[model samples]
Target: MLFIQNIYLNKFLIFSSIIYLIYLNNCVYSIFECAPQETATFVRISRARLDGTPLVVSTAGHDLTCSQYCRNNIEPTTGAQRLCASFNFDGRETCYFFDDAAAPSAGQAELNPNPSANNFYYEKTCLPAVNAHEACTYRSFSFERIRKTSLEGFVKKSIQVASREQCLSACLKEKEFICRSVNYNYDTYACEMSIEDRRSKPTHLRMTVDQPVDYFDNNCLNRQNRCSQQGGNLVFVKTTQFEIKYYDHTQSVEPQESNCLQKCLDSLNTFCRSVEFSPNEKNCIVSDEDTFSRADQQGAVQNKDYYEPICVSADLSSSTCRQQAAFNRFIGVSIEGQPVATAQGVTIADCVSLCFQNLNCKSLNFDRTQSTCHIFAVGQANANVKKNPSVDFYEFNCESQFGGMALCTNEGIRFIVNTKEPYTGAIYAAEKFSTCSQVVENAKQISITFPPPNISPNCGTTIKV
Candidate 1:
């Protein structure tokens, strides 16, 4: 116990020393402004390989598990379990963890676990939780039709999910087609996505009443950065410092005010319309309803703050004076630069604002540990760039002439002259390409089929291979 105490004491001393040094020098503080704790997902299965047999599948949280259980334990969400190895495909990165048990029940009666497949496959997903804008956009649902149905568009093939919430989340993660609406069937557990004509007039979507089915519209779904702050700063009121008549409902425990708001917004059980936080007590009280007529729980108030979240009203979303790239930050990615200049005694937002204000500063890194803001002149978007856990990277959301659009170049591409598809970039480019680049591994090339550019110089452009 003494040895353990000493070890902990040493660690604390070292950490405190670093923080003290940073504070004394007015250097960058290595603390993240936002806590984007994503829900980690992983699967535990019965076999090592996909052999046209039913695999016994189980799921465990990223936080609760044995290290050996996960095949790809390096990531927060990964698993393998006792006998199986999680195999990741080369180009697709699909998870295949298992070997055929080949018991007497291999092909006998129907398989216990239904989502059986001959090949290993997993769907890639993109969530709107990456930033504030995406969260705001995806959650802005115009209408939810209970017991309503849409007979148009494709029904998701393969495994049937459990709940409507799960169905909605799955739709949000779709990389292709913008999922405008979803119809969840309780009986079949079928989750169907639609981007059809009904999506045009979402409010006017034709509905056939089906008791077991529920349809929901993605109101502000893909509208990214549709509103600007217009120099209107959000007000954060410190009410806990003074005693007031208090509301009683306790939402959840959070470290900071932002965490409380984020938790409130993302909650599934109850809608969190407002938040009241106590800095001294470290307790967060959330209101599920918008109305504040009832202060159900009161008294014994000690240094708590009440936060009304309607500062940046949704009215700004539809406002015509919205700035295209006013204030935006991609959470996980960091912009690269050598840091031509550095400063101190500023917040991460201030650092971002500094970069946004400068025409020359393309990308910048705000050192959280050192408390220093470093500016960069040029930093192009490179998805393959490695991320440092300690640094907070900010890039100015400049309206790209090409809209930050680039084709992803990958292995095993055959097309050369693509005229029909307006834009066909690489699905996943391993390395950067210069000019209309294509796959040419060694001396051999994809079977070339020559074609001419249509419509004289053509309205847009075409690739000739």
Candidate 2:
């Protein structure tokens, strides 16, 4: 196991097995800053080859030398000055560089693992700690093992491995495709690498009680960032589509619901509060208004679904907001104050968004019965805030003190930041503001805040921070 650490210093130590590194230095503290040289880093995946035609291939003796080669080269074939994002290194010599255009999905590569083939694949990343799952201890990886079942089809590769461990190891090391699930036959010692799993291909999984085959779906993929790592998950409302009554636009997309949501999340300079997607028609309509924003505008739509992102609010049970501004929910009550703004129809989410967007909007009241949204400059402490059975009140948290807009991390961790807070958590550092910068201009200088301590699972894995 050859490990390379300290890329910024341009030096590396070759490790036989594992390396424990610890170092300290004085640096400006921020909500997104990393402790210098505190953790051992490894960039290359052992015995793994990324699946793609290399943009450039050259011979280099050392791993560090190959790394430099990738950074120095440009897309000569296309006459474009594109830098490589990843590279494959054959242990001895040979370097294959791949540009961003040819890069794999965020947090994934179509890696082919070959025990006989001595190869290593390295991708440049700012958050090496978060993305270095392959380099972590084998025990850190996990899978949902199901007995008497097998996910059929979509098998790109199958091989004979010694045990369940080796089978899983091969799946983890594969580079030819995103290996989502695996089928292992203990009797035949056959390992099947599948690109689809129960989540993506729900119907493909079948019961095989007679066979000695068991299905194992990789859990690591479930931890991949969503909501741009903004600490929220997509709430799918089935058979119910939001009507596009405000700031709505239509686009053609793949027939996947997630792709439709991606359009909403990926919108530039605009907040896509909701989306209506039709898988059958491959149509997506991203809108700034959801049912809560304009309750009368939405109705049932067959063959389509609505999606909205819900941000993680403060948990008063476990942590306090230091009495600094915080999101607080009040049921059966409404803030009574001079209206900053009022809408005829709105929901709690709409009220939250309105309060979040307007710097002056510190508190809001939503009347469920009347579907009315009222924003206020005052908060719950105001004496006028009185009981109203149909009204729900929400106050803007610290987001108002700073002009922080809602942003997502590459991994879908969400937080409101008006200024760049140094990332104090040591879990990860992004190569750049990976996903957020694409949606917000000049956002590369910003860093993601710590996500919730626990991510609720949709595909059977809870990520604990």
Candidate 3:
């Protein structure tokens, strides 16, 4: 019995010695692993806060305290933005920074005077192998809200969500249908995904959706070139039905609408003038030849979808695409459309392009807020030209090309014409028509831009897009 007791005592002593040796060698650590990564939210929160605004960021690094991490890392360029690191989910944390036109958002971001030790573990996130921005740029996300929106149709699919961030994760992971827009319902935590072809539909900015739901654009749109697609490459035209007035059908029975359009575009014999799709039998009619004149769309199925590559270059928003300013200075009044060649979302450059593209366009009205381009026939003279508050009427001001009008105008100056971009001073010229025109002749395409206003006449003169 004594020998057995000694053996047991010796084994216990050996174990204690080994542990002490390991401790002396600094091989042990006191640490807490992350409980578990939760979902992440995609809000465009502003950094400017009156008080206690929280910033949520994902960070990770070994032996990193929040204060040390910020000082050693992301400090110089961004300033003392690293206020406090609070865990949200998906390794995201809340930090503070100054704010942007299209900046993202944060919720429950406002910091608390004292965060409970139980609810949050105040530890820095694990750092990526590379820097934060580089890794973040490589990441993709969806624009789902803790809030929600709904529609009977146009929804590609739906996903279950634990939080607003989780729904965004699912939407980002979607494989099919270019997911540009998402509607989130706060009550049900349902995220409805939508793939909108802005070519046929409207940008979410213009879409008047109801409440209890919020709309997010293709997360890429917020980051100019992130997604390869947002605004399309080709010029946009209205969906209409057309009947080939002169050409004979190559196929006795019309082919599918898509096939027909492709056949025309691919035809070696002739350039596809315009495409007319018939929904009744799902047929398409391709024009045999191109018509550079205004009469091309004279008499067709006005009720269905029509598409034409009418621009000098199909790259409508390309920076290198040059445009000419049609009017010198027509302030406040509008020139009507070319009987038929009316277009919405027209910039000054686009206005010039509209007139230059259609042989029939004699005059045009470019609205600042509406971004609309109205091309009209020259024959329709301004016989009874009246002053109107809604538009900037463009007319030839060849006599007094005084660069641009000032705060005051001459008595004969029925309309004030601006040859450049619009500014606050332009608003002062109330009595005169603000004939606004963009310098499209040497229009340089600039890719960087803020999201435009949601109203009509959606195009601005400064940048072509």
Highest lDDT model number: 2
Return the TM-score for each candidate structure. Answer: 0.23, 0.25, 0.35
User: Which has the greatest TM-score?
Assistant: 3
Q: Write the per-residue lDDT of candidate 2 for residues 265-326, one digit (tens) a residue.
A: 66532245567777688888764345443444455457766665543332222222333224
Scored by CA lDDT, what does every candidate get? Answer: 0.40, 0.53, 0.39
Give the CA lDDT, 0 to 100, for residue 59 in model 3: 41
- After superposing candidate 1, which stretches have Cα over 4 Å from the reference? 1-181, 184-191, 195-250, 253-255, 262-465
* Clashes within 3 Å, all models in order: 26, 38, 55
Worst 10 residues of 1 by lDDT: 26-35
Candidate 3, residues 325-443: lDDT per residue as tens digits?
A: 11333445655443446778645445555444444445566666677767665523643444656565544211111121112223222223322232222222223223322222322
Compose the digit string of candidate 1's lDDT tens values, residues 406-463: 1233322233322212343432222323323444333211232222335222122456
What is the alpha-carbon lDDT for the whole of candidate 2?
0.53
Candidate 2, run of 10 with poorest lDDT = 23-32
lDDT of 1 at 224: 28
Residue 427 CA displacement from its true place in model 1, Å? 17
